[model samples]
Target: MSEAVDWGLALATGVRTASSGPEMSMTEAAAEVAALREAAAAVVEPVAGITALSAPEAPPAVVVDRAEWIRSNAGALRTVLTPLTDGERQVGGFAQPVSSRLAGLQLGLALGWLSGKVLGQYEALPAESDGPQRLLLVAPNIVQAATVMGVDEHDFRLWVCMHEETHRVQFGAHPWLSEYFAGEVAALVRGLDVGPAELAARLASGIRNADSGGVAGWLQSPQMRSRMSGLMALMSLLEGHADWVMDQSEEVVPSAARLRVAFEQRRRGGGLFDAVLRRLLGLDAKLAQYREGAAFTRAVIDQVGLSGFNKVWSGPATLPLAGEINDSTAWVARVRSM
Candidate 1:
């Protein structure tokens, strides 16, 4: 069957759209990369200690520019969306090539826009796959964000490593998580087999309800509702846990407190156009995940201590439900009972 998205086109378009930022000479960029790698390595033990999660000896973090970031994520996207793009099912009406190109262009544009915003990411590899799991630090974006926030660049780099390293530990500690997340993504993509008319209706409905749930409301179809919620809850748990742990970095990072203040301000500071773009891209929802997830993390840790809070990684059953994310008491009670 014909592919649904031209992955090559997506990569090219994304790279082109993601303009470079925070100019650096070759030596400066190399120095930043080396420093970030060392920081990532240094944080592994601390993150494991803070969360009481043990990760296997992992490879050093790969530091890249914006274009490389886009390329790496584009490849991951293709892997996740393979069920929809490579199977017998296809988005109806448009010819195979036309549909593929359109999908690629759309995906490319979104990735391009996001390339500038992300600082570091932990890309979980499939359990059965041979490729080594990757922890990526976007060097230029990290420098740019630090410069924009006016914080100590070295401190900020280590701070970002703390959060990203937490994610690495989260997945590494629970090997099943990568496969589980991949399965859910496949199920969600497979559910998007609707024709153009149904897709259009869904889009209209999504736009109307965008304010209510951000990306969840916008992209949700009946078939994808449960999967989306599960994924969102998992993401909330992961991101929130990382954020909470990163806050405890004041001991090692002297400027951690100041960095947090500046970062939060920057997260909340944006123009009208930026706001619109954020809402459209579900970044607003992402921000909520950080806030709500961190609140839930703090509340649980406060109530039951870090050991009890670590129960969240026990299994999928221990993960917070969609409603439970906003209700820490409910999550705490449910997990304790389980």
Candidate 2:
């Protein structure tokens, strides 16, 4: 069978289309990189203290341009889809180069567009087998976003670091998390091997449910419903937890309140075309995760205190269910029983 995706083509296409925001001289870029690295380092202790979770010291954060961010994500996508391309559950058809190329192009377009918007990401997948996990900070995007939001660059950078650092701490603190996440992704990919008829039906169902689930709802297939729900819940928890931690560290970021207000406004900003694109990309759903997840975290903490809330980090079973995210009382009751 042909490769499921022409990763090289995808990388090239993405790099070509990705926006290079706020051109900077080599000196400016270097200085921004240095500042971001410092911010990432500074957040470690505060994040650990606030969350009561310790992340093992890892390598320094990698600061990349928009094109480089696309490249890194392309590589990670390849790693994730390997099972579908090369393992026992290989997706049928697409043996022709044209088919693979088309898939690559579609993926490339999405990644290229997204490269400009993301501020930072915690890459749990190593570049090479046995390589250390990395925290990637997109310097150009960060600089551009801060300018657009009219916030202090230093404070905004630190604020973004706090959120991304929480992700690093999450995976590092729980060794099983990365593997579990990967496994769920692999399972979902494997489930995509259905025939055209079933695939269409699933897509139709997803569209119908889009009002409720966003893009993620449209992407879900019946076979993968349970797995997708669990994965979504996990993502909601991670994003929400990170946001909560970032807000709690206002002492460190004196402009935290101002930044949050601007950031929320920014998340809600953008014209009609942008709004449609965000929904298509599941970004709207992602924004909901932050809101819903943070609310759940706040409720849980209020009800049980921080230590009791910490029970979530124990394992997969301890995490909230999709329904429970909105109803934290149910989550608290269930976990207490556990």
Candidate 3:
């Protein structure tokens, strides 16, 4: 595996980066898992009203701590990124022996800290599953968010589930989405022509000059952004759709606004260290996905209504182009012309 396997070190260090936090008792974790499952059931019909997709498979909800959450996801990340890593390995010597070790440390620390921010994830592994996919909820993070927001624990937990279950339905109903997303990811990784050392040095340079240029300055070059655009658009659509569905779930939580406020606040106030990690790790892009995507979704739904909006799910081709995400009218107009 060597230093070429930066993700391996990333897992080790990433978990370290995020606070594992105080462990929840087994009983507490189990109870939260059950509550999340219940929330999924309650939300299905209402969420269906928002989108054409349905939760056909009643996947089990998993409640895990920060360490376990990272552990479980690491295997999947490895599977997806291994090809790219191997490709980088071919361009050897450009990366120093210490470079891989340092990258590993950085990755691990980043993940460890990120554990607190992640509320839930839909881990897709159709090859391993005979029944249905798994919905992972980081128990500690959920607890932390609830406490931080001063909201009802159950209400907050359910709110998190709505977003995840919507994710499950989107991927589950549209198997093509899984393949398309993976293909995009693989293409990006395979296209990389540098080793960890060179990449890190560039990233360090990017960070230094990034302040003047802002996110555009150091985060991505023109080619990188073009390559990432389609993936970004897809992510925006999925996340924004989930956010829209969660909001449409008016009956699920009475104080949705406060819940939103709490999460928004949670993303901020990370201190200088946290800010650097977020930029280095590309988390800023992730946070922006929620805002941009939700806005696109809202604009489309307002213009087309739920039934009309279903056209997006009709096929991969119907999905919005990268530029359309920022301009809702363009997406709506494009869909209409089709």
Q: Comparing candidate 2 with candidate 3, which one achieves the higher lDDT?
A: 2
Tell me how far the alpha carbon of residue 26 in candidate 3 is from the true structure, in angstroms, after superposition.
5.1
Cα lDDT of model 1 by residue, 267-301, tens digit:
63121112222343354533686677888899999
In candidate 3, position 103 carries an lDDT of 61
Tell me the deviation in Å of residue 263 in model 3. Answer: 2.5
Which tens-of-lDDT digit does each residue in 1-338 have in candidate 2? Answer: 56757778778887888876897899998999999999999998999999999878888888888888777777776665565555543445643476667667766766676778778888766545466677889899899999998999999989999998999999999998888877776676566554322222232233223343333443457757777677767777888898899899888899998998999987631211122223433444436866888999999999999999989988889988879999999999999997
Q: How many Å off is the CA of 134 in candidate 3?
A: 2.6
Return the TM-score for each candidate structure.
0.86, 0.86, 0.80
Q: Which 10 consecutive positions of candidate 1 have the poorest summed lDDT?
A: 269-278
Error at 41, model 2, angstroms: 0.9
Q: lDDT of candidate 1 vs native?
A: 0.71
Say which candidate scores most in lDDT: 2
Off by over 4 Å in 3: 1-3, 6-9, 22-30, 94-99, 124-133, 196-225, 268-286
lDDT of 3: 0.65
lDDT of each prediction vs. the true structure? 0.71, 0.74, 0.65
User: Which rank order by lDDT, best down to worst?
Assistant: 2, 1, 3
